[model samples]
Target: MNRTELRFALHLIGFLDSVEGFEDGMVKLRDRRWLVWHPDVMAALFRHDRDLRHPPSRTLSPLLGNRSVLWLDGEEHAKYRRTLAPMLRGTRYQALIDEMVERSIAELPSGPVGLAEWTRRLTLRITGRILFGVDDEELLAAFTRWLDRRLGSRVRTLAHRYLTPGTTRFDPELDRMLLHRAETAEPPALAAFLPPEDLRDQVVSLLFAGHETTASATAWTVYWIDRTPGLAQDLLGDADLLEATIRESLRLSPPATLAGNRMSADGMVITPSIYLAHRRAATYDHPHTFDPTRSPPPPGAFFPFGGGVRHCLGKDLALTEIRTIVTALLRHRRIHLNTQRSCTPQLRGAAMAPPPSLAMVATCRR
Candidate 1:
């Protein structure tokens, strides 16, 4: 590994807003390693997933375990996706998600709340119920502790990558709880559909991927809505506009900056930078500005979920949860930003997250 390049990547991923002189197109980071952000290149790479393979197992195996879908490729990955895609897309699950969102919203604390923390809990609660088939606070809290330790900071993220057997104190027990829940869960629980052999890793990966990324995205969307004058009120009436606003929020602060790294047949490593692609002026008018009124992005120009057959299986579920929470919260309460200063993205594990200090105060709507 090129130590200097690796360090630069880690810093950029952790603190995306700090990046300067970022350009579109393919950037060669090291011999045989490249970063591609140009919409055309991203489209090409995503279109031909078979030509590219995932990063080495050691990179993610420690945190997600050996059998995580993130590590699978070719037929194995395709089969896994086929099994899970229908469940996530099922209308039956949408009803369950709406119920969970309403319940979570009812529990939202009155007065000032940290946006990141509040959303994290909301998503964890929602995701836990789906994956574990129960709302066990102890399990949720333990998982949070474990996740925070692994991806709380740039240092921790790097160490987790380079260190041997990167596990927190909550392991073994948490693993057991997740696996047991998945195996025993009945229909309608997401865990019930998961394969038994890969139960542990799959459940862990789903919880982390399902909640963490959505939590960050949800928080960022709320932050932007509060920042824009009259936008929240407008959203209450216009469903399409509400989606557009969320899309804009995603464009500004994509939860995952780089789609997973892909290895080419010739030993070249290529990664599509969603962050960069979304910022191209050609694709987005006044790219840096947050304007939901702006024209919709072209097909390849916008990809909060990575492109291709490898696109996130939980995309529909995530959007449903986000839309439900945002719609319910807006309808039930009027929330305003606690600080005048804007919030920026901070990398939390694999997600680009809002800082914990970003807060808002909510008052029930009369």
Candidate 2:
């Protein structure tokens, strides 16, 4: 990691003991001025008075699309969120678990396999089916390529979004597929409020968010579980332990490490660091340790999917997918990390993914 990235990681992991005493819980970085890491203050910033602040749309618009719910705030954000909420509810999420399990089982290799890569592919397939209603191999391949290119760099993504013609429009066949699925599947009520363009952008945004973050979380969960002997069996036997395992994995290594930068209407900048907040000693005992049995961090302190009104719309879907993947894996196989080398976190695009070389060996459980 570069110096800046290393510093950020240290902050996120609570290794920087010196930061525990910044005045008002604010630290200045570069010329941008204030960076807030305190859990309580950051939580309040997210939960209260959201109307006065908005995410950094200028930076994200190119990738998420200008009309995406991620870029909207206040009444506009609420309107879209309400329309999309039903599709991500527990029942809807539960309905997708069987398919998730099937996919994970089908994709698992016989020996050692890169857990992160496999999970990314698994999540991409799952989200592709859910969002587009079809899992055409060619379509998924194309989407993965596009996502890889766009997420590689912010400058390049902006250039591509602006310079490339028809970049804002969904593929014709994919759009038709989604529309057809909407006829039978539970679709978001976006058409009532948004134009076709905005609706398309919203669907695309959801697909990106749903696939990437869940993949990272699932990989990390598997990595941690594999590291601890008997934990996988414990997770399979106890439902609460399974839930705690997922929560602790997210707390330790949230995919979306930082919340989108929020700029106040009055020209003040409020940077909400989900990573740092998760590591805050005040919010968690032994913040760096991965203890599934630990009491859950209080509400706002552990926000892997973020907080407040703009919290990830796919939070339920992501959690369900992670639970389903982990449960299925454990039930079918005993998971162990390849002990030849240590696994670490690596920044991939917008998420902190498991190291590319990190592999898990899964043996069929008798």
Candidate 3:
């Protein structure tokens, strides 16, 4: 549990514009510096893992988000990012997660359901089927446990599984599958587009990034829509607004608040201007309210995906997942707030994995 005062301090960052201030309503927090003091900064902190020296340490472990790509950095990060870049950035790979999402949505028969878990299951299923091509009951369970943190993924326990013969060779098996898929698939296929090892890393990257952020963002969008009336009507009326809602929700309640950090190792007298970007009234109208209908956020107004060279590599996948889920949601149901459940969310893992109760009662349409 995060400190209540700390959480309040973090939430205040996103509301900086609410404070009367400079033209943009942004406040200067320090010398020659303006800050927005955004709420989502807390989410960013959850995303960035700066210490690479220790591969599997108490503080920084490669989020094996069902085998994530977060562990690699520097040259490894660049290489992995490049190989998989086109798969999502272009039209061909856009539908990769879409197909999986459609199948997952098919499971939601016309009735009331747990919107948070439904969203999580869709995201997890997409990661499983489309991204990593992983299919292991125990590994999936372990992955969920690892994510939920009711149980931890211990080095010794993970090692024991690998050591035991006939146990799932989760990573290696996927590597071989990627290689074979590349060998057999057409020349322009995604598998063929990436080198063998890079293909493996890319899959892991997609699995981690593809699901987690989208899941959180989707939760926020749902929660926000449920809580805000006019905003919900606007979103439901225009399917197109769904994307805007995602972006605004991200601005209001960022997916990973701390990812914008620039460390000294980044080799510069670095300065961060995230707070200014978020809180500046010039950048957004009524910047503090969770209203999506306000003048759309400014160009490069938010960096939920971070900025500069190490900006989020899986941004496309995450956006695609959010758009797909939100669009489907607008078409099929009306989401109402579950006032009875607690609205508080925890920063799970290295991102804002909202606790599975955002109080979205899904009412089926026709």
Best by TM-score: 1
| RMSD (CA, angstroms), candidate 2 | 4.5
lDDT of 1: 0.77
Per-candidate TM-scores read: 0.92, 0.83, 0.65
Candidate with better lDDT, 2 vs 3: 2
lDDT of each: 0.77, 0.70, 0.54
Question: What is candidate 2's local distance difference test score?
Answer: 0.70
How do the residues 1-366 of candidate 1 rate in per-residue lDDT, one tens digit apiece? 575466545777543333323555556667877767777777777788886788743435687876888879889888888877776663546777778777867776786788888888888888777766677898789888888887877678777777755453238888887767777766445555656678778888888888888888898899899888889988997999989999999898898887787887778878677887887766776888999988877667889988886788888888888888899899988888775665666776557888776777778889
TM-score (C-alpha, index-matched) for candidate 2: 0.83
Cα RMSD for candidates in order: 2.5, 4.5, 8.2
Off by over 4 Å in 3: 1-76, 93-99, 109-113, 133-139, 150-203, 230-233, 236-240, 265-285, 296-301, 340-342
| Candidate 3 lDDT over residue span 85-186, tens digit each | 665552454566667666665666555566666776678766555443444445445555544542122333334323452333244544554445435544
lDDT at residue 109 of model 2 (Cα atoms): 81
Ranking by lDDT: 1, 2, 3
Alpha carbon lDDT of residue 83, candidate 1?
A: 75
